[model samples]
Target: EEDKIIEAEAQKLKEKFKEKSLTDKMKDLLIRSIYVEMLGHDGGFAHIHAINMTQKKNILSKRIGYLASTLFLDKDNELLILLVATLQRDLESESYLEVLSSLQAISRLANSQIMTATYDQVHKLLSHSSDFVRKKAVTVIHRFWQINPNGVVDIDRIMKTALCDKVPSVMAASLNYFIEVCRQKPETYKDLTSSFVVILKQIIEHKLPREYDYHRMPAPWIQMKLMEILALLGEEDEETSNQIYEVIQMTLKRAEDLAINIGHALVYQCIKTILAIYPNEALLENISKSIKAFFSSESNNLKYIGVTALNAMLKIDLKYAEDHQENVVECLECSDDTLKLKTLDLLY
Candidate 1:
């Protein structure tokens, strides 16, 4: 009877240990593993996972999940590598879904620590039968661009392969990454970006566009950058890019009413670059006339920009606006646009 009681007590203790929640397990793991490897105190998260498994519970489903969950979230670099290892080798789709609460935990982690292993894992995720994994993998890869400095990233290769991904999300993300890089300062990655755009223009075989692609493929970055790059280039380069940019801008500008929810700043950048490049006489003969018409019909923000660009032009070559003052006055009188326009009129 004494032996029987002792065995029962041991069994009860085992069960109790198994039932401890994920947080308690994290305390054990961090204290043991991560602390030693990273923090120098201890070094083994196996126990945390051990406890978590014994409990048959989802770490993400519990409150302390945030602590464990963020290990794979955006900022935690080391944890991201660990999570991608699991994503590729440890967890299956159905099990991962039940075990993890937020998708961001896995996706953002991958976005933060992309490497050969992570890249392969992302390809696997894209190839997964699950649409969710494929979609998330695509978005995660695109988000990867935001964290990568140019020296570290193989952007050309990524842009190359991503343009042809079987999945829409992957393709879109890759294109967007390229586009975002276009907005960056030239001194940082000018040659690479310019070559990429120029290559895109010549190889009509892999043709991209200036206008927006509402379909699964949107290449606004490539589209605008291609035009802007060409505009900044010498005569031959400008000829190709300028033709595309001018037409696209004209169409897009017409479509965007004054009350848009976004995109004013990006378009403004395009306009600024063009005004800065055009010669005073050429600007007067070419841009000034249409610019006046555009401002006359535009909303407040457009008017403000028009005035600013005009002033800058006048500053650079007094003859630009001075030569076209009659057209400017006509647009000003008919401006009937906004208070900003009226203010611009008085100021000018």
Candidate 2:
């Protein structure tokens, strides 16, 4: 049956083209490989590219894309492919995107499966021109960091390179992705928060207002990402919460990090993030009296943030329940569902 099929294809090719140049031969090879891939033999794609009939048509890496995506569905296969792809120093930019996409798919694979990340390749792709391509690299790298729960991306090196990104989209993508992975594995990223720290520190040194020019905002993808990681970090660590508090303090006092409108919105969002992830006792014990110390003296923004965080504190065990009753009453009066349920249960 195989012999008959080959014969049939030979007959079709011969009759389809009696005269062909080198260019035609190359096109034929590409078309045949595409056909072969469609028939399920993806492993042969590289060799297929190597045998191109045209001298001018460089199809080697481009043809291999079809093969790499299949590796995305399986971890063992992915790691083997990653090793091979990473070893090839001349890989075109397209191959990097293929690799990044494959790794992105890995997040859906079995959680217990362990695989190696091509941190070198990921670092390279972060500099590419395409936003989508660069963004995929960010997601894959950040996810890997989450799995390792350690700062393997070389925080210092990343900080040095991050500011070099020609495009804010790329810079934001890299920083925000790092933050997300840290959020996922907070216990591992304490020192790795340098990017955010650096940005905040810069804001303080220049005495810049939180209000920056609205014309130069982080890309939408980056903004959402920072928000996500912020919420996650707040949910995971006391130190992170405190650090955010410090950044907030810096933002309030320095007022140099943002412009008036953007600063107002971002400050609210930042403190909200801090409250959401602050955990129940993360603040009340050491900072409890200190928290109440300035409760009534600040901006309405401060009051809102304090009350929200205060309500989170109100959910303690029965022994500590009575201490935050007024804050709980304040929380219950608001019309948010989650806030209402949390405070009403205590009141009843």
Candidate 3:
């Protein structure tokens, strides 16, 4: 019955498209039909309309077309290769929005064939004039790398430049890409540690533009990302750990001064980073205080993170977590069953 309704809908859409021009209403209905087709209906009815929409001069039509194509076409679909030329043209469009839309589609729809065909165009956008375009380009390149790492030429240079991108959004996307690279081959990218450290210092000093600030905190997401990457790079490397120690201390102190919600999150990430790098006695004392402070919060989320961090701390040194026995017991009385379970684990 559902399939019958979908086929009826598709037939109505096909009749509507017979007119020389599309009204906005008709365009919307078409997009809806493509969406339904995407839901495993296998009607195979929307592909031609979707492709024609991509060739339309109207930006809205192009956007809907790209979106529909991304949703309805599988990576292995033969039709996907047909969009390579269209995507390349849009990637070079004078309008940044067009470029952004194409990049977004490629990011989602890219396969080995699509990545190889459009790799150069996407790479050029990494240095596009608009920060918005640059940010999206960085993300697309990351996706392409995942599909075919060798397709991205000079990645080391590309990443180094991206990490230092003056725009915070671009830098943030680059950090995400770098994180993936570092995770898989830490030694190859370990030398980039100082570069991340420099960025962290700049953020800590409030050098980022006011636009990146959240609740008066300077780029907390970036801060968190830097901490994450640092944690990854510094793990099991004593020299890297020592190099990052001062900034880690500064970050902890800075997070402590922010508003409660954001502060708790930063502190939680900091605790994880600390554990990864093997915190010293001083840092352990700070983590102990931070975890206990979390337990005092009325928010269950804070309590859960606190409990988890404490469990981790216990692994490093029983002495720091010993005083938190009362805090753990208090958590058992809370209404949150998940938090209770985590606390129970800690207690066990």
Which candidate ranks first by TM-score, i.e. highest?
Answer: 3
lDDT of 1 by residue, 1-348 (tens): 654554454444345445656454554443333223333222222334432332334444332333343441345444444444344443343554532322344444545344444555544454556545555655555655455544335555656565565544445455555556545543343444445444434332224342334332234344445445434442224433434444434423432332232344434444554554433244334446544644664465556566666775565566665554654565466545664465465455
lDDT of 2 at 51: 24
lDDT of 3 by residue, 1-348 (tens): 987887777777767767765656656866777656765565356676676678777898888888888777778888886788889889889998899889988888889888888888888888889999988988888888788778787877877788778888888988888788778888887788898898999998999999988898889999999999999998888888888888888999899887478887898888999899846678878888888888888889989998999889888888866688788888999889999999899889
Per-candidate TM equals 0.47, 0.40, 0.90
What candidate 2 gets wrong by more than 4 Å, as runs, is 1-124, 127-132, 145-160, 163-166, 175-268, 272-308, 313-340, 346-348
> After aligning candidate 2 to the native by TM-score, how far in Å is the CA of 102 from where it should be?
5.9
Q: Tell me model 2's lDDT, rounded to 2 decimals.
A: 0.47
For candidate 2, lDDT tens digit of each residue in 1-348? 765565555455444444545343645544654554455544243332332221122444333333433332344443334333432332243545444444454433312233243456555766677766566656555565566645454643553365445545445656655564564677655654445555555544543333432444333234434545555655656666666655544444332244444544554454445446565454334334433432443344444544554555455334445555565565656656665664455456
- When sorted by TM-score, best at the front, the candidate numbers are 3, 1, 2
Off by over 4 Å in 1: 1-103, 106-117, 126-139, 142-155, 165-169, 180-273, 276-290, 293-299, 311-318, 323-348
Cα lDDT of all candidates, in order?
0.45, 0.47, 0.83
Local lDDT at 18 for model 3: 71
N/CA/C clash count, model 2: 17
Leading candidate by lDDT? 3
